[model samples]
Target: MTINVPGRFEVGTTVVRRHVWGGKVWSAMPYRVLEDVGDYLTVASWPGLRGLVSTTWIKAFLDDGHGRDQTIQELASGTWRLGWWAWQGTTVRSWYGLDAYFTVRQYFDADRRPLSWYVDFDLPKQRTRMGIDTFDLLLDLVAEPDLSRIQWKDVEEYEHGRRLGLIDDRAHQGVLAAREEVVGLIESRQGPFAHDWSPLPLEGWRTPVLPVDVRSGAVSSGLWIS
Candidate 1:
């Protein structure tokens, strides 16, 4: 389904994303909408920033109240830009765990191999008067592009989160399932992972993120700001 104006999140619009740790608000992230194409939109901190996020509000859901990340969307959309960038924040009712960033495309170079996925351990997003927000727990998981390797970063931090009751069993399991599911997609070469993900038309656009002092997270580093 395409996004129409009036109900659309227009380009150049600034949205607030908050960072959370152990269920408390640590900072607020301000980002700009770079593109608002029908199938997908891109939001980033700004140029030279390290993270990019894409996805839209929930299109539909079952009464069971299941709201997984757009891994399903990644499969169903069938339309993709041949890149593996991820963005932050969410609009649906939040889930408590890590956020998985899946890579369906890779850079076109001799060393084209890239990490297939990365998981940002964080609290689920929360809606506030200021804006929609989530917290970063500082731990992460990385998977080699070929799906042959996986590793964790900041293990101590995540352990701390569990001690604080932030990273609970449900959250941990959810994150694992997400990571496994995306790896399955890449390994099977299905859906968005089809066609080896050769580059498409991204043209001249970049992601933006707020400075560390003001706000920062997995996708906190970027080229421009809102």
Candidate 2:
């Protein structure tokens, strides 16, 4: 599914992250499309954007005591209840590569100043009738807002997930390969790193709500990799 628009437009779509093992959805975040050309797609989410996620995430990350292992275990269990979540704090714009293992994100403050670059290490994205589908590997890489001085984030959780076999050999290898690809982008100033730090303008855009299928816990629509 190629998205070739004459220019950037606001898209009413969701980005769903499912577990690699059981096809259970971990999150289904709504996004406003910024740009869609060829194999790359850019989307934005602000404070009011609503989405669906596992209750485990709310307990583990939002509250306390649930820790990484329990989070991974319950997520892999594929039986957690889904709940609504809203984006808070800052504005986030995500850049997705149709066939790349990681997505690039830039954060903005209240004044719209760039904050930092967030690299989420995950399985490559697939286009679905409802939106995009992918798996989050529990690992991340962060860079300065200027897209420099990169560093690995969440190593402990990533390792723990591996130990628990949530990230199997194949997925682990994919993460390693993705690490190299992300580093190359930063080092060479390619991809999102090569662009201006300014975020895509989103004036007069309303926050998108989660898809009905996601809200109702129905199976995701058809998905296709580039």
Residue range 178-202, candidate 1, lDDT tens digits = 5676557657855444434333332
Q: Once superposed on the true structure, which residue ranges of model 2 sit more than 4 Å away at CA?
A: 1-21, 64-66, 215-226
Per-model lDDT: 0.40, 0.72
Clashing pairs in 2: none
Show the lowest summed lDDT stretch of 10 residues, model 1.
89-98
Q: Write the per-residue lDDT of candidate 2 for residues 1-226, one digit (tens) a residue.
A: 2232333233644344333335556777878777767488888888877777777777776765456567778765666777878889899888988678788998989888998899998777666555567778889998997665988888988988778766778778878998998898899998877878675678777666665666433344212223
Could you say which candidate leads in lDDT?
2
